[model samples]
Target: MAITTFPMIEKCTSIDRENDIVVTDLDGTLLRGRNSFAYFALVAFDVDGVLRLLFLLLASPIAGILYYFISESAGIQVIVFATFVGMKVFDIESAARNVLPKFYSEDLHPESWRVFSSCGKTCVLTATPRIMVEPFLKDYLGTDIVLGTEIETYKGRATGFVRPPGVLVGKNKVDTLTSTFGDTQPDIGLGDRDTDIPFMTLCKEGYFVPSNLKVNAVSTKVLPKPIVFHDGRFIKKLTPLVSLLIILWIPLGFLLACVRLSVMSFLPIPLQYYAFLATGIRLIINGIPPLHIKKSKGLLFVCCHKTILDNIFLSVALDRPVPVVTYSTSRFLNIFSPIKTITLTRDRAFDASMIKKLLKQRDLTIFPEGTTSRGQFLLRFSSLFAEITNEIVPVAMETKMSMFHGTTTRGWKWMDPFFFLMNPRPTYEITFLNKLSYEFTCKSGKSSHEVANYVQKVIAETLSYECTTFTRKDKYMALDTIVKNP
Candidate 1:
């Protein structure tokens, strides 16, 4: 069956009607490796051809053992080589094709092409071999007139040598496109790789996709399509191996923490700081990717009054010294093991002075939400702490668990720990959203209540959590309950 051409839609068609947008190149410029039809073809499949090849690879030893005797009689070596190579290529190609359509839905392909074709005469300018990419162009991209390296073909076989235009690198790409298309300039051009920079410079707008980072960094405008792989995805299937790795991490991490603590107890004050830094590194190694912690630098984290161990996990997540902002509670004063840095209670003027001192020294971490809530809910902010002079590097941490093993339900006190020790289950993913900054309204002008609400909103937006202002009176029956029980 002939590959169906995708029709361009209205969304992709924009710019001066008088000018033209000539697209150059594939696999990064116009198409992303991940979200492209090619990417889908390679990844999204039930029984992938690669799997079949792998199965053959696994079975090869057994087959070799069985065929040892038969090998001497027949040309076994030649047969095996032919079979494996043929099967590997066939399966890989087939799997790629099967996965492609799922990524580029029937309607999306046409919509994209309509945007492409509508701009001007659309053409695929790529470094990939023409024969290799043509089928994809015909089926998924719906673009003809592909400018790519022509592979040498003797009859049906691909010869080792490539014909003229041997190298499609750098200026070669631009010269080839300009020479063919002539003086009529393309209005818009897109490429993912640096090689397309020359080609992009020729066009009115050149869109370049950066390394694993989408939203082209180049000064030239980028097309919104194929920036990031956004299919209508609900559930991400984790392979058994990945699930196993996640499960194995719990015990491994616990043991490392214990060991690190033991070593730190005997170390000097300076070494203790190093130990704190090492803790952050350990977290990164153990599967918890860093959130807002850049360069593994130390941070002063101001967190909500939730569980006592939020800092511990946050520290683990950051893999750095997260100086937690804490109240001058007597219980915390006595317990110094977990306390990285302390902010002693002082007069409002003194508190401001102390905050300034802390800010100048290290990276800070803070949870604008004053109180913790039931796992399902978020509490309002108490921004008495947020009246700092520096920009508040805010973090919204959303903790999700398939099973509520380590979670606290309603009526739980602040001291009550959640996500402590539990049997291994489906993974609990803690995501730290982007850091935000807040402008301090005024020394006396910004009401504490207003600051609290603003902080709450920032946290809610970042973490996609529903934030509610819950006072201590509304939540707890008595203040004594926190001191006595918590």
Candidate 2:
């Protein structure tokens, strides 16, 4: 005596008397690996099915290739028909049971995800022999009906001849299913192979699995969004793969040896030195930050204040014709110094006029924060250069795996680059968040103050940092009062 049980529980729903017939296909839809499993079953049953199929083709090369393509493309029809003709009915229950683990798993199989509550009356309508498939039906699939090929048996011994349900291909599949369940219909239909096409067509809407397959079993193909797997790491498709690859490869030994001496040679010169050096300097920065320029036109980069080396690294990373918008004294300092002519004037009264000229002539880089924090808290940003007409791209920079604000300006001299030289190797991570519109269109009809807060909040969120806002009164409040007169 054998037993029957459904693996998952089903939700009970009384079928409306009007429309209760739910017909679906089995092979590629309900049955995950029907073709390969059926082939395995035939091999297990006849033991020479593989050799016989091969010998048949070896006897006739053309017929063998045709058979291969037929088996590959329309697996359900060829395997079922071939199995029925190959051997007498034997107990395929064990063979079918053995194949269950391959088809279903907690991982790849989608059956567990979509089955929902299994209280409803269900059945599996397949073209496979009933005995060879009943195990999957009893174990993995809880569907009530199993309408497949009928195998002959005498005293539970082997008899090769099989009787298939009348014309079990295509539309006849819908008829078989309807005959099994009568007027009761199911809520969902699924199929994968081309032979299951007619069976799926019986349903209102059905989805094909592994949708890229040429011969889809269902009309509408439903598939998960593609995720990228690179070197055993999963990433979203939109994430920048090339930039990440460059970052990871920069710390390699061989590549470092080749370009290290060349890298050290440019250290004595100001970052602006490499900036104007042009050709080779351009290639180095291109490897660091790959830019996606639109129309080959230059754009402005708004950044945070870190150090003088900050502007240099920006110039090198950007590689484009961007002139840093610094103060008049800084511009004067760079004029006699090794700095290029791209630095802008920071005269307060003429700030608006100068910005218009910079946008018209060249791409501008401005540190909107105006002052530097110890790499910890983001300070209130000055709205001075925020009104630039050119595109404003906010660039957030932080060192990877470094102590918070490694050396503060209070302890280290602001003018000297000694701290940078003395410190051990620093791996700086610079991430360029997407470009914002040049025009500051206030969202939700926000006022200037609200807009400023929003911009500050947006930048803070983008960099994964916190910021403190100080009003004019807050700054004026005696530092001695907060310090307790000590």
Candidate 3:
């Protein structure tokens, strides 16, 4: 048996020359072992990109079936281009600029980089939209001959329709390469997947990257994993001792919650601290340190929602029992929980009055996102609370679990907390930001929506997560039917 590696180019060639064409696929061949569109969607954290990814995840099964009859390029075009519908070209370009450098620095394959930089007439032939690929290719990589899928735009916004030639997958890649190069085959071709075979055949030399080889060669700062939901399943491989520990912790947690609730009225702070210690959860604070502002009255804490256990973690980290304001529908959780909270119904007038009253007594916390999220992004903040208060504090929260997720969209309220405590050591980090200054708000014209969006952006930036306009309703609608037996 003999061992072999990819052909390595040592010297550079003039890319401007027409005869020196070197075509490469973008996703796995040029970058890491991932799709460029998927990587961009995760890193950019743009609302449209996230929603587009969701649409693709949902429609992939249908697209898979359609692949049998139609061209793979057409199927990919239908699934991917739909995300760009109505997205402004300027917005997409801006997002691309922000993420491309990080991608090139962190996710580019070392072997591919050696091949791409050595060739002068490099053409990126990919199924990813040209709108995303061109900016990176021209501005960052210094190669502009990209033959990617063209997205039709109307009035400077994406129409979500792929142009006539369709996606550059399979035979479409060869067709586009021939049309551009005109009977002259590429000098070299590099691809990772079987779909790239068509274009590879048109080259004098072709290299297929090994599947098992580690592709991404990041030399810069580590990027955060994109916030995507995965279904929760019971650990079938858990040791007997671990399983017994998890089972024992459930009843113990219920007993502790009851004890905390019993004394919460008279000894609220002590009870909260006690419950936190009993759970054995840890805190790993970062970004901004948790501080207890002396002025509790008339203060509004706008925080990102992650789990039902968020209040417990916040109370432990801040060393104070902060009252939380939640939706009326979620009031049932309060029946057993120890934290002090105010429940608000849909009535705008009544809710405002109640929140104002609560703020007058003590510091109040509101999850402006209005529901729990995966903690990788901040959902759209409802402006109702912003309009009611001038003194606002932004809080960014993240939860880490080793065994099981304590919080999920599908889990029932009663059992969610138990699932959280069952983990050997579930940790939470809470960062408290300075109060939103009145002077800054006044300069921005002091609109409630503006204030809400500003705070949302601050939290998103602090956590290195995406800020999105997607709401709780959007989350439930997208995920409700898809996830099963969580």
Q: Which prediction has the highest TM-score against the true structure? A: 3
**Candidate 2 vs 3: which has more TM-score:** 3
The TM-score measured for candidate 3 stands at 0.51
lDDT digits (tens) for residues 1-486 of candidate 3: 111233433232334445466788887777765434344333223434224545545555565566557666656665555556677887676555443443454566666766676675778898888877776676557675988988888999888788877878878888899999997778888877778877787888777654323644844432223313322323222233433454455566556545433443345564555555565656665544434474356788788987776776676556677778877434435565556777677788899899988878888888888877763677899988777778788888887776555655543555566666555666688888888887546345778788888899999998899888888777766443333222
- When summed lDDT is taken over every stretch of 10 residues in candidate 2, the lowest stretch is 227-236
Worst lDDT run of 10 residues, candidate 1, spans: 226-235
What are the lDDT scores of the predictions, listed in order?
Answer: 0.45, 0.43, 0.65
Q: Residue 86: error of model 1 in Å?
A: 77
Q: Between the candidate structures 1 and 3, which one is better when assessed by lDDT?
A: 3
Q: How good is model 1 by TM-score?
A: 0.35
Residue 221 Cα positional deviation in candidate 3, in Å, after optimal superposition? 12
TM-score to true structure, per model: 0.35, 0.35, 0.51
Q: What does the lDDT come to for candidate 2?
A: 0.43
RMSD of each: 18.8, 21.8, 11.8
Candidate 1 per-residue lDDT, tens place, 1-486, comes to: 111111112223554543465665655444433222223212322222334223333444554554454432122222233223322333323433432333323223222333464564677776554544554455544565677655454545434244566545567688888887899788766555545667777877654443242332222112232211111111122233333343455456456545544543345433543564554422222223444454543333444443444565565456544566655332422353454746546466786677677777766655544344433346666565656643444445543333122322222322123222222221223345333343444354776567566656755664566666555444543111232332
